[model samples]
Target: MPQLQEPKLIAGNANMPLANAIARRMSMHRGKQVGLVDARVERFNDGEIFVEVFENVRGEDMFILQSTSNPANDNLMELLIMADALRRSSAARVTAVLPYFGYARQDRRTKARTPITAKLVANMLVGTGIERVLTMDLHAAQIQGFFDIPVDNLYASPIFALDIQTTFKKRMDELAIVSPDVGGVARARELAKRINSPLAIVDKRREKPGEIAEMTVIGNVKDKTCLIVDDICDTAGTLCKAAEVLIENGAKEVHSYITHGVLSGPAVERVTNSVMKSLVVTDSIAPTDAVKKAKNIRIVPTAPVFAQAILNIWSGTSVSSLFEADTLSPIYDGTYAAE
Candidate 1:
């Protein structure tokens, strides 16, 4: 571990539950160590965001736990201000640990003259004097390259993979990992390999944003249980539509595994009414009430994973192994009870 004289932990206004979880895992003296500022955001008559960090963080290694969840802009501005405050306060280092990096989808210019919003966000973080980044399952991996400072893109796959093994024990081999779109083929394939299963792909043409995607599944999903894997589940049109296509193609069962559950608009209703059996999401960003109460939804806790990463980072240990999801011990792996 890099022996710093005094290490500080700063919790941003976003995802306080998760931040507290990480703090508890660290065994830090709760409110005494990791402090929160009022950060009472207000919109002026003209609609603007203002923030203030009330805590003093001189010569401290500060880590700000925030997620760019809903109201992404507001939460993002809060994080930026927190980092700038820590930097200007004479803190030794500042690392922005975002469990969910919002606006990650706009990582590239799909069309001519389009802005790469993901890159823009990266610039904002680096410009604000963030020393490093520790985030999970960003919409695109290339978002890491956009940052001049080091960006550790963490993975939730190990937690999900282990959950899958226990959730469907004997039937895992009969599974065909399906990607909702060709872009997610790599993620689906990675999960499939962890469980030693085959992979399938769903090819689709986007009709419009927020509309059901008309997809033609590319692989043989007939007579096999299908799991559609992706990084994020927003609106969930693609997942629901993909499930329909797979079922129409003779899939025995359909499920969706997504890392971040940005279930905005009609996502919950769509998934509830779709042919999908269940939607699995991680507790990276806190779930909305609809998702929390949905019978067809299951959440895998990422608190332990985030906590472990924080400890490792603080101790100056390598964190690359944490990104490999399949190696983690499952909650139902016949051991939690013993503890």
Candidate 2:
């Protein structure tokens, strides 16, 4: 068999800092210098998206790093158009690396006349020349089935577990891992297992999309430091309310580890005013100005993870091993040992 071509990385406007960080990590892995493909993605006066590639990509494996975060439509469109351009340019393979996949909450219809927008977005991606997808902590795992091509869904548990181990070193015996709601108990349990902490659940009744009717703590949390885990934190209404309820239930302190910080609307204000000691989120979605200024909100880098995944995919290796507990030691020290 012929040797596999070196992977080419292109980024959209959603999160350039993260894309650049991933590029840097990939460069370190390759030893010799590697950089993002020289490309221009911009808009015309009428708001039409335009893409131009400066270098040849013929027969090269291509990966587009774009997160469909806030202003979801524009970023999503940019990914599709970029993939189409690469396909026309005769690239061998095109994989979309979406750090934060928007419209994921609309994976299914909750009522009449509502569309499964997540599936629609998946169709749109496949309709473009995208051959595969690599994303982190999708809101719903079933979204993977929406695409005909291969989809690799990575988890943030390893990163969060390592951070928790470092932050609460002497307080492990006093820690209680919490799920913000029943739907997230599995995610919370995974982290609890990794850290050998007890598990708790926040039983909440959602009156509507952004409102909560009642909430109760499920397990023992008295005098214990509680850590809530979830996939997304939009508006932060539910997260803040859960923190309040946990405090009222006699928890010592409340913190959170969320995969995607889609902190839109009044999320920053609510988090600031809430009882949470701190809210930790991944760099899946780029932070806003307000988020940057918030004292209690911290961001964990996912670039190393994505960079390793891209390299593994291009080399036909196992992506799941990236999350194995034993193999993640390098992540804690800001280094990755490439295989």
Q: Pick the candidate with the highest TM-score.
A: 2
lDDT of model 1, residue 156: 72
All models: lDDT?
Answer: 0.79, 0.91
Q: Which sections of candidate 1 miss by over 4 Å?
A: 5-7, 28-50, 211-213, 325-327, 330-339
| CA RMSD of each candidate after superposition | 3.1, 2.3
Per-residue accuracy of model 1 over 249-300 as CA lDDT, tens digit each: 9999998889998899999999999999999998788887889899999888
- Return the clash pairs for model 2, or none: none
Judged by whole-model lDDT over C-alpha atoms, candidate 2 comes out at: 0.91
Q: In model 2, which runs have C-alpha deviations exceeding 4 angstroms? A: 332-339
Instruction: Residues 25-87, candidate 2: write the lDDT tens digits.
Output: 888888866688999999999999999999999999999999999899999999999999999
Top candidate on lDDT is 2
